[model samples]
Target chain A: MTIASITGIGWVTPMSMGCGRDYKTLTAEAGKLPKLTSRMIFGERLPRFGRLDGYSKLGFAATGFALKDAHLDQWVEKRPIGVIASTVYGCLATDIDYYETVVPEGGAFASPNLFAYTLPNVFLGEVAIHFGLTGAAFVINEPELSGIAGLRMALNNLILEECSIMLAGFCDAGRPESFQYPVEVTPGAVFFVLEKTPGDETLSYGDLDMDIEGTIFFKGAQVQNLQNLMQRCIAVQSI
Target chain B: MEIRRAEIKKVCIVDTAVVTALGNTLQDTWKRLIKGDSGIGPIKRFPVGTYDSRIAATVDDLRPIQDRSIIYDLIGRLLAGLKDIPQDTALITATTKLGIDNLENIRRKKAARAGDVLPSSMPEMVSGKLGLKKAGINVSASCASSTIAIAQGSAMIASGQADAVLVCCADIVTEFTFSGFSSLKIVSPVPCRPFDKERSGLTLGDGAAALFLMSDERAIQEGRKCMATIKGWGIANDAFHITSPAQDGSGLASAIEMALVRGGLQHEHISAISAHGTGTMYNDLMELTAFNKVFCGRKLPVYSVKGATGHTVGASGGIEVALATETLAAQTVPPTAGFQNPEEGAEGMISSKPVYLKGDYLLTTNSGFGGINAAILLERGTNL
Candidate 1:
């Protein structure tokens, strides 16, 4: 079996936003707190952000950063390269919006755009279509550990030769005013690219730094988001 | 697909259970499907006559208990006789929308439990009810969710990482999905007529099914009833559209061809095909195109249970696979319910009466809103 190596990283946090390898500049410029915007993160690469919900926006921006870090930004590999993402409350914002469109009196004011993103897996579709990934992609719903579980599934697929490269992570935004969850959350997304180890095809990718766990094996990785990368890797798939 | 040789493993489904609109159990559901019974009717959750559509294939008992609880009940009934779960058993769940009914209640200021709105709660409920601590996956591949779940579960077992896997899928007819499809103008007022020239759109439904899968060796050692063997599976994305299939059916054909290649079989060996057949103009047409292209008009006899069971969304794939496996075991092909006439591409390939065949293989396919396609190949129980 092939051991998956985390080669590229990208994250969105309350205080930082960039590729995973830019630890020094991110730390030095840590004072620039909370600098993750659609324009700043995605530039002019992605589709118009006006139509997308917040969850898709957060995930799309992080995916763009990961693709950049993996040097697959403008290329489409003939081989299979997929995505797997887990979310705590996947698109709850849009779910609320879509639901408010209907009434009990046989009147519905639903928006087709909002209805499209209601499914949690739509995030994977957005990243797949945007990045031109046409392989086996999956969406997992769990706690923060969903990210690690997503990574394990990605590795399993890679080992089985189902896909050559994978982008696995978690993205979640706080619930709207009406809906109440057992736990509170912040708007965040963290994604990483995983590939089989010892590959000369991806030397352009900086280094194989992080493991299956969310731990950053690199130095000067004391950022808050780095310290707590989507909760912890709880080894949920080791059945 | 470029076919490649693979070291195949022997994974077989030991037992199965279902809670469909047609019936509560697999046997009852099979009888209704074989007889071409229509489980579709007018919507009762709310007034539907005001909209362009008014019919759906809803479960007889969708009220009083939450829709998410149906999976729990089904799993409990399925595992009632089991005393213990194998330590190596894993869980893989699939559903496109989990607890959307509860979310709708909250939006309408109706009484709703907080846990119903949580997606993780479904798997957590399954694990907790089954008395397990390890985490499991909840797949959300739109309509292909459960198909991918079963495929991935089989993959895990075949790869020697898991001894058994519990695969479950469920989806309920909700105002969210009903109105969403209605807003898209794809919900039929009457029963959906899949593959028929006059077919208008799909009919949403509520249901769930569970399958306990294990390797053939394990099943024989434990003396479990191996219903069918999971021969092969495949997944692909069209990258074409967000809510529709590729115009030429290339993505679906790729998935079907890959499943056949992986199963080490040819089109001549396949006895029947279970299509996605959502009754939408594009979906049925695209599936027919793929079938004609892959089978080359061999009269393989394609059928879609959606007309009888309603489009169960996430649960349709798993239920269809289970029914197809049962058909293989019994040596019969269920009729394509509500199919009055075959469309242009599917001429002579669909029938309204149960067709008996003496082949070992069945090809099942499903496509979702995100241009994702999944196909699975199964062998008869006797072959295993």
Candidate 2:
């Protein structure tokens, strides 16, 4: 089977902003876990582990860079074939705001602005709506593995006669309360424009030698190994 | 690699974990289900003002695990004996609403910025919790998320990609979900009735279910007890509407047909069907139409366990598959609760009582938003 390669990689993490820089640069700048930005506003009630902003801003930032990385900015006017955006946590902010008003305050209506973010796939929807790429648009919620799964799903869709170019990735603007924890919480988005044509671009990312393997019962050790493998793969590619 | 027979070698309900209003474990859930117990109750987790529909099948007292963590702890007490852990396993989680339960609360307060909710990222939290070495997460299509996860995991094994795949599907009941469905007017004040004439709407529930998939050859080689084999699966899109299903049921019927073809069986070969009867008027009607289209009036005992366990969003598909597996293993299908009479429109479509049968094949089907539909065939161990 002809495997799909990452022709372009665009990312927005806490360490840095865009895919213009490689993973190494981002990892190198990985400093101590930042304080929950919400804490500054909400005090003790804020979460300990979350990203800096939210997913939309981060998603757009990443998309812009990834389009440039893939040299598809020129095709932005024409719009691509498909879009698959996966997020473990959808637009939670919108849901929270909408619920607080309607449920507690006895508000008769929900804010249409807030409601716009209600759909978890709205970020991708916005990208499609903006780009006018209407081939196939899907939103998947696979938790942390959403990124890899999004890539694989895009690959499969391309193979199964779904679309030609697939914009696949995962994005999340961390949880509010969880941001206070000791862990590294960052709002990030990563996207790749997968195409069948293997275009001629000097900086083109290689195809992923991917294999979806493992048993249903995974322990801590197995998860760590998978993380290590991913880290190593990114590191090797960087080198 | 010429794709020959797409045989799903071995599928293990390796680890089943659930958090519902009934209980947390499979045993507890089964006990509650057998006694016709209701997980729905007054809304306590969040303040429900004057909402007429205050009932829900909620998982009470679920704390936040660290970001990117394993979900085994949700059913930690039940898994005391299984010790042989695979070191290099991949993790795949399915969920509809991830980590938005509490974040929604904070967002309401406007206490935190929007960016702070990233840690609640469901897949990252689950992967981090499990600490999976190689992982692939899939939200897939709507209610069929987890089932599709299982199917994808099985495909991974069949393709010799991974030795094992841990597929977990989880969702939590939140005010956001309640409100969204309520806006759609699909929430029933009372319990849900699948295929019943008086069926009003579906009551939403939250829970997580996990399973393991490995090759039969590998399992036998390792002397592992082979629970069952995933015979085949089929996935398709309706291309009709975003929320409502196509009335013609062409997409669903096509999926069923493809599943049978993939499993190398005829419609008569299936002993029972675990249906996606969401208790909604349109969903039940469409599913019945699809069933009749496929079976052509063959009375294959059909069961919808949503009555016992409210519609569990993404986890519904996986949980139903687990229930179907148990039913097949026990050779006794549980009766669909609240199924008094078939709907006027679906008269000859649904089965009223649980019929005892001696067959090796079970078919499970799930449909989700975005016109996504999936079907899987599970044959008895003897067939393997």
Candidate 3:
């Protein structure tokens, strides 16, 4: 069995923005997300933070909080800390934003800034650059942004010793405006910093157990979803 | 503490299939590749009057099925040639933009499947068609999507997560992508000349590929002929820029070094390299810089299929993997089509003629828009 310690958790949602342990219950109404500034998250200027698309902005803010919660934000050198993020409607809004530029002016007025952020993985690169992380980084597109898939894959990488640490989560900045069906998608992000289970569990939230087949378990039960797992970790820590 | 070490399993490529501008099957692609034919041509699928670079290696004959997304048609043609894949095999689909045309239709208020807009939809459709138990995850790491997918599948098998995996990827040339690249100003005005002195930029292409991988014991039990060995793989981000690679090529160098260490092979053991030579000035120079850094200026043979097939975006890596198996079997690296004059740094490494492989292992590398670089090492297959 491969075991990992959940050292930190962070999320940025319409309801709240803070560490997972400090997160409040889901009672706040969903609406427009607050303007996330680098000063609010990092207390310093993040290079290229202003040019990021909304999707990358949401993901970058959440990852920054997670690193801060883990106290790994002050690193002076590069580390092999990988990142694996999952999403459902990845960069669709940005895709639309970029596409709209192509229609009016016969593509002569296409925006390279918007074009750069079209792929979901661009934010991964952004976060890597911000944190000086040099490990295996990629994005997963799941049917639903529950983040279990990415979490499992992160555990596998840890088991295989592919990286020293991993930041695993999901971020969905839902289509700002849908073209059809008026579909509503919740815009939020949740990230957890994971590392090999340490001998000292003093700062760990909980232990994540996984078999070689990639089935993950926590507290002797199979992990159902990201929300449930976060709740369980918070509950155990509060005790 | 009863800590159990993860047992490493031997992963092998049993079967492969591809549909590119050059041909519809691996055999056809290999035949044309060795003969040094270019499949890239002027674009005709959509209106290109407004675009600066109007040519691409498009599969011109493939019409959308049922007036749906062209990606479905591309996938159908690529999968129709594959056979006998295990029902339990996990599926991982890769694409920079899956069914992106559907988004165009939805925007223009035309009929289209809304589900197809999501990258996950590809695996959902493929799993339902093939009755796969698991609706696999989709890797959307820009152009490195399929390469990372292959790496993930190999990791799954190496860690005993799945007995078999089928990695299928597809991408089509569309106005959206054409316009995006045009905006980036990296589209070559002519057919791309990878690693060439006069290389302008990349020529976009339409392509798809399906590679089935299995454990050595499972392949032996199923009596499947192994085509190549999945020796090692690594993925890394440049952390330098989103769209541009580091000038020093340290990111790709790290990935290649990681792959070498994982595979337990030295740089000299690699017979040749299948480079992600997209023909862009910065990209070609970056690849040469990385090769020089990793191989210590040994003058290793390097080649690119994009010169013939154009840059297939996410599908390029998968297509190249299919080509790598053939390269390993035939012990030859195909000519870098469109390559007439080699770049200064790539003088002895790239050529317009095919080169015979001198070793069993081949290194295939790809760098994408998000500064994502991936490298996979493949060993010539041997009987179990």
Candidate 4:
């Protein structure tokens, strides 16, 4: 089956921001923490220890870059695109703040504005809503692999299930201290635009190979036997 | 493209590890399980006020290695003996609440930490720990998460995506999962009694299990011992309620039927079944109905280990499969610990005694909250 190629890539991570032109530059200078882009929208002194920049702003910036990378901004109205956005932590900072405001204060809250961001997939949903995408919009929760799995599933749909285009990736913007064990926090997102097409034969992310049947050997004398077999295969391949 | 029942050749459980209520190390947990002991105890980690469910299978002080970095240490332990894990081998992680236990702790201390509970971010931490530049983490479909992880890993290998793949599924008990199940009023106050008529509900437990998969040709070349072959598997969605399974077991039965069809077996070929018996009213009943539908009223030995190892959630499928492999290898089926009386409707189908049976085939099934149902067939040796 001819699977889709990741023609467009957009990313925002603690180490880098934007995609394509800016992304290459940012990633080249990696290992630095991303700025608190959400603080500007919500204002400084946001109570949360780990808060990303405003989700909408970050998402819009990433999308603009992705569309440019895919060269699909103009075709957005005509193309049936499947949008899948995933995250381990959604807009948790916004949720916690809204909850506190409503429960402790008991008044009309401006927090409803943040409710849409709480659903981890809202970034993708927002993009879909903005583009009027009538195709499938899926939100998966697979912690870190969400992006890769999303991309794979999208490829499956494009090739096997017959979808035209898929916008898939992972995104998260939260502080490190917000976790049980605090590590330096970085805000990051990566998006890919995939479409079903013949293999480029020249350029690709990497070849995808899958095996549905395999052995799972545990503790036993057979372990040595299995080890020998592995060694022999590699040896023969090398020859 | 034709779907061939892919042949499993070089299977290597490149890594195997566990974190159970008994102890941190796989050796400790295995010792406890082999001795026929229980890890259920009072909830000490968190205060479980007058809620009926107080006892649980809690992990001992993992506090020492609570940092996300511990996952790497655990992986290192699991892969200690393996020699042929290629640098390019895909890493697939399955967990219900990835990194959320830490997030929950932060949330309790400061509500602002809630934003850290997303799933997309967990793989990076794990991959970083494993020194894996290429990996994937899946947290979809609840209890079947790890099972799906295994399935996906196998698929990756079959598709030639990688020479070998590492599949790890882990989850730690947290206030969020405990309280969430508590809110559903489905947690038993005592140890779980899967398939029992008087069974109240499941006892939530936490643990992690990892499995390594490789092609049969590779295994033969490496001389790695092949333990068991994944014959076939079926995955389907109920599209039903988020929590409650479809009462008729339509989705569950379809998955089982597909699994059997894929395994090239009739209902009678199954030697035994490792059920998902969560000990909850709805889940147990739904499973019973589904089993009956698959077996067509035939009597087959069935057992659930939840009584011994509480409901491990996403890890349950892999853990149970591991136990089932042992059972098949040893040709000894352990008695369902808490099977006192079968439910009124499932009396004819439930098995209570630990009957000694020898058969090459075993069927393992798991169900999750989002109406996700998965079934996999395994055979003792490849010839089956």
Scored by CA lDDT, what does every candidate get?
Answer: 0.74, 0.61, 0.86, 0.58
Write candidate 4's Cα lDDT for A44-87 as tens digits: 34343133235534554465456555666554343456655555
| Collision count for each candidate, in order | 0, 60, 0, 62
Q: Is the docking of candidate 3 incorrect, acceptable, medium or high quality?
A: medium
Over the stretch B39-134, how does candidate 1's per-residue lDDT look in tens digits?
Answer: 898778765655788888877555545533333444455445344566556788788776777776666667767666666776776777776656
What is the DockQ ranking, best to worst?
3, 1, 2, 4
Stronger candidate by TM-score (2 vs 3): 3
As a whole number from 0 to 100, the lDDT of residue B31 in candidate 4 is 54
DockQ result, candidate 4: 0.09
- lDDT minimum window of 10 residues, candidate 3 chain A: A20-29
Task: Report the lDDT of model 2 for residue B151.
Answer: 67
- DockQ for all models: 0.37, 0.14, 0.65, 0.09
User: TM-score for the first chain of model 2?
Assistant: 0.70
Segments of candidate 2 deviating more than 4 angstroms: A4-84, A88-90, A106-146, A153-239, B1-19, B59-83, B105-141, B348-352
Q: How well does candidate 4 score on lDDT at residue A218? A: 17
Off by over 4 Å in 1: A25-38, A45-48, A76-79, A144-146, A197-239, B1-8, B66-88
**Model 4, which residues run further than 4 Å from truth?**
A1-85, A88-148, A153-239, B1-15, B22-35, B66-84, B108-122, B348-353, B382-384
DockQ of 1: 0.37
- Tens digits of per-residue lDDT for model 2 on B67-171? 311223343322332345474666666765555554564544534333223323444444545566644554545677777777666666665656677777776
- Highest TM-score, which number? 3
True contacts kept of each: 0.50, 0.19, 0.70, 0.13
